[model samples]
Target: MTLFKVLSYGKGFKGQAIWASVCSIVNKLFDIAPEILIGIAIDVVINQEDSFVANLGVVDPKEQLYLLGFLTFLIWAGESIFQYLYMKNWRELAQKIQHRFRVDCYGHIQQMDMRFFEDQSTGRLTSILNDDVNQLERFLNIGANDILQVVTSVVAVGAVFFLISTKLALLAFSPIPVIILGAFYFQRKAEPRYAEVREKAGQIASAINTNIAGVATIKSFTKERHEKKRISAISDEYVMANESAIKISSAFTPVIRMAILTGFLATFIVGGLDTLNGDLAVGAYGVLVFLTQRLLWPFRDLANTMDLYERGMASARRILGLLDEPIHIKDHAQAENIDLSGNIEMEDVTFKYESQTSAALKQINLTIKAGETHAFVGQTGSGKSTVIKLLMRYYHAQQGQVKMDGVLIENINIVSLRSQIGLVSQATFLFNASIFDNIQYGNEQATEAEVLKAAKLAEAHEFIVKLDQGYQTTVGESGVKLSGGQIQRIALARALLKNPPILILDEATSAVDNETEAAIQRSLKKIADGRTIILIAHRLSTVVHADQIHVLENGEFIESGSHETLLKNQGRYHQLWSIQTGGV
Candidate 1:
């Protein structure tokens, strides 16, 4: 995914890009015509009896100047027209390519496995989507056109020089190879420095985003000054990185300038002698001098143009590398979309996280029949929530099988399977939208009355109506405007609106206060009967009423029975129960 690949991806715009480049070169050709006109004006003044213009039928010198003036107007008008064209075409091309990059990159990112996100930082991804795309936009808008025109100018002018006088042309073109070599050398050195600068930019963006999202934690810990110092350190690193790139880019112009001077001096001394010795026309000699400067001067901007190119290529590689990564989870070619029963089963399932040495869930096997309320309780890291991940197929089980209604989950269409399952987790995340929008997210097709019904069933309507804007209240980022209990209930309302055949509530009420816990428990009792419920919790008190409770210890189910039956057995569940109830 180099700069060439970035361009190749825009083959959709190939015809347009080609035309825009053509316009740039054509405009420069006309722009350089005025210098040639100046040389002819000199010819008319010095060789009045038989000048080039006189040979074309305008015998009078006065009339020749007037004719040259008319041609000047036409040539300039042509230059202006193509200049406008190249500018519009190039800028629009930049916009189209940028749009393509963002849409394709983001769409691909969404389809990648959940494990991909775990290994990447939000800020770094944001940098690629926004900053990297913009970098390519800038280069496409102007840098590309400038580079093409500069090369055209060199080629066109070099041909003109050689046609007039080969010996003098050699002098004018002597330093061109050196100037080119210097440019390549600068690119080789600036490429990696600019790449480092881009990395620093992502780190800085990540630091700022993390701090803003966790402002409350910083405030509670009273670490504003410490955070500022950390942010400043990151900012300093970004500055130093840019400084390194600047050092290389800034040297390009001056170095190329020396080469330009060498070309100019050789043409000046040699061409001046040729004219004085009667071997060259004074007018032609004048043209060579002006054209030499025209050809060499623009190479100065080659520095800035290459600067943009290097930065853009670095960004393109990162963005394209992300797109190149293969997606691990995909539906089978013939996966069926069928209705699911509430029954669920896990048969000898063994799962391990990529970062862990041991299995998170070792040889776990369990089942929940239709319309059953099952609970799993265990210590943290005991794989209580790992079951939910397995059920959702967020990560594939390393061993064994998970099935829904006697059908292997891997054979079911992912979209159909997820649509039938509803989950409300410990960490509730709501969009930056109104309360109504968040709830409606579960079933976007749900009517207003259906949302209201879902809210009432979850016991959230009473408090929602008291808010200043009622259902219209916007939840700040991640619903930060609401309390823990309010957020949890809203999440519950969202899941209830989905009306899935299977529901998983993982630590759903773990963070709420005693009163809120009682309220959620009451709501749970009302809605737990019609579907299969899998409740994973760390608090033993909440699951005591489940129809069947399982005690998970070190990734294995140590005991399972009705709540009262397990308590009577005095097993692990009973010990956890006794501790919560103060050994009653």
Candidate 2:
């Protein structure tokens, strides 16, 4: 699978490839013409009247010499022109393919399910998209060009050598089989080594990305030295992997050179003997000598070219594999847009994560009527978040149906389905942009006035306006410049701006202070009217006013009632409520 199959991608660029190859071959032919000219000039000098040029009717020595000079200029000029054309063609193709492929690969990735991201690392994905694609670019830029020229040189030179002296040509080509076998041997061994190198590179990138993102946590825990050691260990593995590939690939040139030396020496000795015996013309022998070196010297470049090829192929395998990965959450063929009325239902739903052995949600039936607020309370790992994920179609249920209004969510167009739901999660993520931009992220076309209105509804406008630049203040990476309350409120503003019929807030206020939580609660009450709100909160007080409350245990709903009824029943919800309120 790692072996480069150029036919896979090369088919599309057949025209460019054909022209590039033609340019390489024709340029090489013109380049070799000068060597032939040198031999004929020698013929003209030694046997002016009987020279090969005399047959062409340039009998004078001076005239023949001048003709060769003129021919040299023309041939060199042609060589330069074609060299420029081939390099430009090949390099332009590489750049265009790289840009187009990156965009296409990213588009495919955007359609994959949430589980795909859970199984992949940010650093590893970044490495593949940026590093791996760039590796292919490097190879395509010049490695392919080198390979084409090498092949053209061999075919063109071999014919000339055969014409001058067949016996000597056979001796010169004797080591070719050995050289071919050696190259194959090197490729076979280098492939796995390079694969390991690429894997280790991803690991290193993942480790670095983790460290950078968690630098604050590292300093908080005083684990700076420990993190450095951990990163260094991963980096050492990368170095070791590269070293293994290098050891095998670096030996290729020296061994090929030795084989090339053998053939070169044989040709020199045999061709010289033929000339001394007058069996071969001296000028013809000169052409063979020059052609032999031109043919073999480039084999050294072959080693570097193969190295690039193997590395690029290894990266390509990973990239292509990702592009071919199955999309599990795509809309069904019969899917259609639904005019959502905010009513939601989960009927006998059961679901399990692909990596988990047990079901995350059992046979649970639930409903939230349009404009009604419902809350789910449970301890950690009680599948609160999984419920939200299912309703959004971030995952699919293994059994039963999840419906929006009267239509099955599975039969709804995925984009339309998601567009009907607005979500504000516990961990709020904001882009590095102005506060106005972050608030308007969910609705890019929302006017600045609408953004400000949503911000005020989320109780974020007060603090935003207090800042020096007000709405235009930039929130650094992940909104790091903003406090937890500010981040959550801004996220709420974004969700509200979308103004979907269904809103799900999962532990949205858990991390904020009591004062901020109270402010958010007021905003929530204001926005909760005329919309279906599904609340998943660890903070018991936040759900006190919810229309209905359900206590979830394991993967099933153990209790369901209004807040007053749950407390009166003295069940699981009562137990949690008592602990938080200390029985008031």
Candidate 3:
């Protein structure tokens, strides 16, 4: 059933699958011909001028032997040719399917909502994409062909046995039902075990990924040995899971072999007795003995084939299940691109995280006009960053409307809407690439001159040029090579390069020193001519010159005014400002 599901999912490759299967069956047909040829050669030697070959008009014994040798050459050559064809077709098909599945799965993951990622681990997803997808590819490349050939061998050889003698044919196939029942039993027992093995594999992958990502923390805490033991514990669990599956699968082969041995011995002893009594031809008995091994030997490989099938199907289920995860945040059906002027409004908006009991933002109403500078100053968990997330449409508000320029945010094409806003968050992420590439990532089509200009505006150019490689320098993963201040400045420059109508600095200057922060503030002033700027910061000094500041406490604005007006009111904003300025 899982095989059929996988095949249905990849129906575009049906032609290649059929071609590979045909080649496998044909090669198997040629593979069995040698035994029949050996039987014919024995007949020729035993019957001489009255041989089956002579009956075909050869008459001479030597010429009959020569004809048989020629047929042997052709059969071997045909077998080799079809073997190559099937291998090439099957392997190539495997590569194509693997490539398509990985690409499509990754693309689907990119489109998933933020909540989906909250529930899944990066390591588990990576295992599905890399290990699980490759598992299926392995089955397609080898196991599929093996299955086809085994069936072909049984059907072709069985037909020959029945044509020669019914009673012996019946006896030869008697153990077949037993083998079938054993295979079914093993498959049923192994399915869940292999599924658990795959799950354990994912868990170990997650553990390793987590440890590697947090190696710095572990080292700082002097817990290297502890982490190692933790990972070893996970690995041991994985081994145990695999051992459980292996025990079930391993028992299959011996059971099948015993059944096959019964069938082989029955044909050998009975057919030999029949030949001696003159009831069966000596040549026919020889064919039956040789063909019985050919018919039954492949069943021994059934255990290994089923092992691959169960593992592959388990991985297939995980991969397909990930692909089926719903995309909760989707653009409206009739959504169209719009040229926004950055007029944002959240009218009585309420939002709660799926895992949380309390609302993050509660019936909040706010508005920011085009080309205006506004700042949200709040304590931790006061929903400053939540506002930015809603504005970017990363998460939809559970109630009320978020609109941009009078149009509901969901009604606008998501990509077009996000493209018009440049965001530099507190936690900056940079790829492991040259500094110039990281800055240019904001707008891929940005010119080198434009990137340099944005870097200058963010006050990162002076420090960057002082470095050994300057803009060409490689920043390690997540900009680990740079200091926090430097990384934050580069993130700002990247956003500046986008030159969007709205620029959001969500605690963007939190990592910089006072001097660097002052320089960035001056740069922001110069660039604040025709763009909307939303600043979320704890540093009251940085937002002193903003056109307006809203003080939020527990997801509601308790005070809203210009810096001087809020200070004059002597409310929560005045208390925060006084504490920071040491005037409390």
Candidate 4:
């Protein structure tokens, strides 16, 4: 996105922006008059009734004094009101920008393809979305407004100074060049240092996330000391990066202070001499002295303002980089909704993992007629799971197509296409939520009755009913609270609840014992009727009754036949069956 688009986050708040800006300008205007007021008060005591305001109109000295007091009250009061208004606007603008950027970042991330996530670290994304965005918000909330207000102060004060005494104004502004040059020098040096800090921070966050996620592995290998050392290294790198920026930024205030002192002394000496020689009035001299400090002291804060600006710009670059990641895979403009009816086919297809050097499936073709049970039998890495992945459209095929209902899968809306299929994998994953929630996760709007029915069909109802809280029991992270068999059955129940037209069981019973596997097979037999079902399991006995079976070896289908035919031929399927059943 362009800078204008990003800044447009403040569009709807034009009233707030204008009111706040007006308040800030007015506050500074009043603030500059106080020195003039000091000079005026001195003039009143010296000139008596002939004071400036009195000489202009009123002859009463008392009323003139009252008028001075009223002006003082208005100046102080205007300053206070504007202070409140600007603070409110800056804070509200910060909140709106923070809310907007975070939502847009998340929305963009959601639109990215699965491959993008696979190649990026979760901790890196988390840092960008949370910490990086927060840094940008902090700068906008205070820094941007401060810069604006400071510029206004310089301009307002400069015009007044030049109007009263051009020579004194020139003297007062002598240190400006020095201050600007110092700020520029430091800004150039601080940019890379701050960028390094952000990078190191991301590294530290990534290390912490990895260690926490793999805590079990660390304990299993007795590598606690090793992990601690690794974390310490990352933390130290971040600290060093911050220290580098701090070293440079810390010198900013002192240098500007020296330059400011020079300007203040010049204004006091030259303007004071002019007044003594009667070349300038005492009131004018007083205004010059007070205004000089007012104009120059704020420059001392340039170090802080520039610090915030540099940090904000660094963070903005990182955020924009993430948002700029090119999307390779997206929904085609002409893609239509999938009219799914469970009929599936693989036509002369060749597929490969994005990270792999060779294809996993080459020119393989197959068909599953509507509402039929088909089985894929393969050794490890023999392309059984690849076939399932192609059918699910997790990775696109390099050549040919996988189709659903006679339409190319690429032409189908991903949401509609996936909605028609349900899968239960070997290592079942469950969220740390209630059992009912886990089951209902397959179809979030599923009713309690539907969930129970699905659980009963998967033979999970017996154990679920035996639990302390029944379906309400918290499953713990990844179902660590349940046994292996219980998790598999719960996963099966989840898939059953979806009631999709096509079902895939990828070693769904491989993790279970004989009794549980048999129970699952019984449920599968019942549910497999009038639906396209694909079973992938090591236990060949499960697919003995399947309508068709394909045995794979080395990414090629070696045999495909019924149980009787395969047994008669005594091919790979027969050998797998004999090995699984112990040659019974």
Candidate 5:
């Protein structure tokens, strides 16, 4: 059933599949023709002038032999030609399907909601896209053709058997039912075992990925042996799962071999007797003997083909299952891109993460006017960043409307909505690329001069030009070669390059030194004139000059006003400032 589902999913390749299958069947037909020709050759030798070929008017025995040789050459050439055709078509079809599935699956994942990623591991996804897709590709390349050819061999050979002698044919084919039943039994038993094998494989992949990503932590804690043991445990489970599947598949070969031997022996002994008694022709008997081996020998490969089939189906289940995952945050049917002017408002907004019992933001009402600077100061986990997330539509608020320039956020296209906001978060991420490329990522079409201007404004150009390659220097994975302060500056430069109407600095200066922080602040002052700036920070000094400072506690705005007014009230803001500034 899963195979059928995969086939249907690949219905787009129906024409290719059909052509490949036809070639496979024709190839097998040609492949078995030599044995039939050898039988006729024997008839030409024994009957001489009265041979079957002679009856067709080629009375000379030597001429019949010559004719057989020529025909043999043609049959071999046809077989070789079809073999090449089938292999080419099957492999090409497999490659196209494999490519399409991976690209489409990745595209689907890119559109998934953030919460979907929270529930999945990077290693598991990697395994499905790489290992699992390759598994299916392996089946298409070889196993699918094997299955089709085997059936063609049976039908074509069986017709020849019955045409020569029905009684002998019936005896030769008697063992087939047993082989079929055994194959079905193997499939039923192997399905769950192979599924377990694939599951264990994913677990091991996840374990290795986690260990590699956290190798720094493991080394710092001196937990090398512990991590090795952890990975070894996962590897052992994978082997055990494979061994369980192998047991059933291995037993299949010997059982089917015995059944095939029965068929071979039946044709050899019975057909030989009929020939000796003159009831069957010697050439006909030769044909039966050779064709019996040809038909039954291939069933020996049945176990291996079925193994591939079950494994591929299991992988297909995972691949299709991922594709079936609903996109929970896609744009509405009527969603359209709209020009925005950066004014943002959240009215009675409340939100709770699915994993948490308590609300992250509660009864929040906020107004951010265009071309003004506003700051939110709160302790960790006090919902300061949650507001920024909601504004960016990363997660929707469950109980209120987030409006941008008088339009409900959900009504605007998500790409258009996020494109207008430049976010520089505390946890900055940089791709492994040149500094110029990383900074230019925020605006793909930005010219070199524009990038330099933004970098200078973010106070990053002075440090960058001192490096060996300047803007051309490669930042290792996640910008590992750069210091935290430098990485933050590059991230800031990227956001600045966008020149968005709304700029959000979510603790963007947290990692820099005091002098660097002051430089960033001065740059921000220049850029903040005509853009809506939202600041979330723990350093109360950063908000001292804001047009409005709102202090949050337990997801509620506890104090709101200018920095001077909040300090005058001697509330939460005042306490935080006193602690940071060493004041009473």
Candidate 6:
């Protein structure tokens, strides 16, 4: 859908838009009146005794001139006032639309299934949120107002021309059809070129984002030169795409200028000849000449306008495409509420990532009673994290139901279901914010004392206290200011502060040093005392004390027993332990 049409659905802005458009059109009409006035002034100066105003009603030339001055002041004032009004309305509307669209897009992204994120890269998503949204904003800020004024200029000038001199006006307006047709042709051709430019820009954004995010990896591998060449290639493609569109757009104004000059010259030569032949008045000839420029000069701006529209339309398509993404996994209307007591069950579960893919999980069945601690140990690509993701309702198993306290998870409202579960993953992400803010992010209502308590439990408080500003210290982008162990601890503290009845720590201690891991283990033991804990870890030491351990491989649970019992079985878990710890 077009931006205006998409935005028109907002009943709240309809009246404002109408008022703004009315003011805008009226302002342009008044703006065109000055050229008409200039023609009338010439009429009065050259034919004072028999001017149109004197012949009509005001026979006194001095009174007529004063009346003209009054009208001139009114016209100028009206143009200035409405100019301000339209600008204010257009800019404010642009801001509001941008804000609303960005929020809606972000909210939709949040609701999307984890599989969507797993398959997509962070850099690409960043391009959509930042670059795509700004493109729409830039269009609305300027293009909408330009189009309105163009339409107003055409209609208002055409009406005045028809009233003043039909034949001469017709001659002057002759080139309009040709100009408009040419504009449409250029618009059609330039649109695809601009779309390519926008796509290339998105790729550029993705490449830069990926490189910055993986700077450490590039440096470690001594691949900066290779990375630079890759980035340069993408950047060059972006520049070339823009240049292709620019070449076409630059040609537009010159061609339009030549067409507009044809009409201007027609008015100048024909109208002057008519005046000399006494077929038209001098002032009338002047009006036709001056109005010709007023009518056609704005088309010069069409190059800029068309350029803006193409960029906006290209960006709009991408933004709207994101908005149009179907919510395939919808919440049930009559969904039940999940109890705080976390009695969870997965029954005969099976799931596939997409329609064409084989099941990620098959015939999975398990149960965890309230306040029990369970763990899963597995190799890479074993679908261990996938289980936690399922529990979090990121994806629904097609074949079987997942239950929380006898209420099917699909039946529970997603918000409430999530509120009761706290998850800490191996890749712990911390926002660029104060240490205190990051810790309190999960539980915004948490008191400072409560935040400190959680931080202390996760062994994050000690390092935080040692920082220059203690809890108030800023964590650089993605917690780059802190070490991996520190970021993990802070993330753990954030989850701890949430104090959910159900906690899922998916390899939460995998990145930390042994000393930090021991501290986290102590914290985990204390926290797991009264909560339902599902620990998914490749680190065997972390889950050794769990009440039960499930060894998963290729999405299936191959062994289930106490940690010691699994070790005694001499199976996959035992083999993993031996390989990892050099113990038999």
Best by lDDT: 3
Candidate 1 weakest lDDT stretch, 10 residues:
1-10
Compared with the true structure, what per-residue lDDT tens digits does model 5 show for residues 72-149?
899889888889989999999988888888998999999998889999988899999999999999998999999999
The Cα error of candidate 1 at residue 387, in Å, is 1.1
TM-score, cand. 4 vs. native: 0.91
C-alpha local distance difference test of each model? 0.90, 0.88, 0.91, 0.84, 0.90, 0.85
TM-scores for all candidates? 0.96, 0.97, 0.97, 0.91, 0.96, 0.95
Instruction: Indicate whether candidate 3 or candidate 5 has the larger lDDT.
Output: 3
| Per-residue lDDT of candidate 6, residues 1-584 (tens digit) | 47565566345677777877888888888889989988888888888879988888887778778878999999999999999998888788777877877888899988877667766677667777888778878878788888888888888888877887788788888888888888889988898898888788888888888889889999999999999999899989989999999988898889989989998888889888888999899988888788888888888898898889888888778777777777756677897665679899999998777744667787899999988999988888777887887898888888888999888888888888898898889888888999999999989999999999999989888889999999999999999999888988899899999889998898888878998788889888778778999998878899889899998888899999997898799998889989999875
lDDT of 3 by residue, 468-488 (tens): 999999999889899888898
For candidate 3, what's the RMSD?
1.4
**What global local distance difference test value does model 2 have?**
0.88
Q: Which ten residues in a row have the lowest lDDT in candidate 2?
A: 1-10
Worst 10 residues of 6 by lDDT: 1-10
Per-model root-mean-square deviation over C-alphas? 1.7, 1.7, 1.4, 2.9, 1.6, 2.0
Report, for all candidates in order, the number of backbone clashes: 0, 0, 0, 0, 0, 1
Clashing pairs in 4: none
For 489-519, candidate 4 gives per-residue lDDT tens digits of 8998999898988999998877788778887
What does candidate 2 score on TM? 0.97
Candidate 1, residues 1-584: lDDT per residue as tens digits?
A: 38678888779999998999899999999989998999899999999759989999999999999999999999999999999999999999999999999999999998888889888889999998999899889988889998898889889998999899999788888888998898899999998999898899899888888999999999999999999999999999999999999999999999989999999999988999989999999889889999998888898898899999999888887888889999877798988897887988999999998988989998988888988989999899889898898888788899999999988889889999999999999998999999999999999999999999989888899999999999999999999999999998899899999999888899998998877777777878888877888898877777878889988888999999988999899989888988888995
The full ranking of all candidates by lDDT, starting with the best, is 3, 5, 1, 2, 6, 4
Off by over 4 Å in 2: 1-7, 10-13
Worst 10 residues of 5 by lDDT: 1-10
The total number of steric clashes, by the backbone 3 Å criterion, in model 3 comes to 0
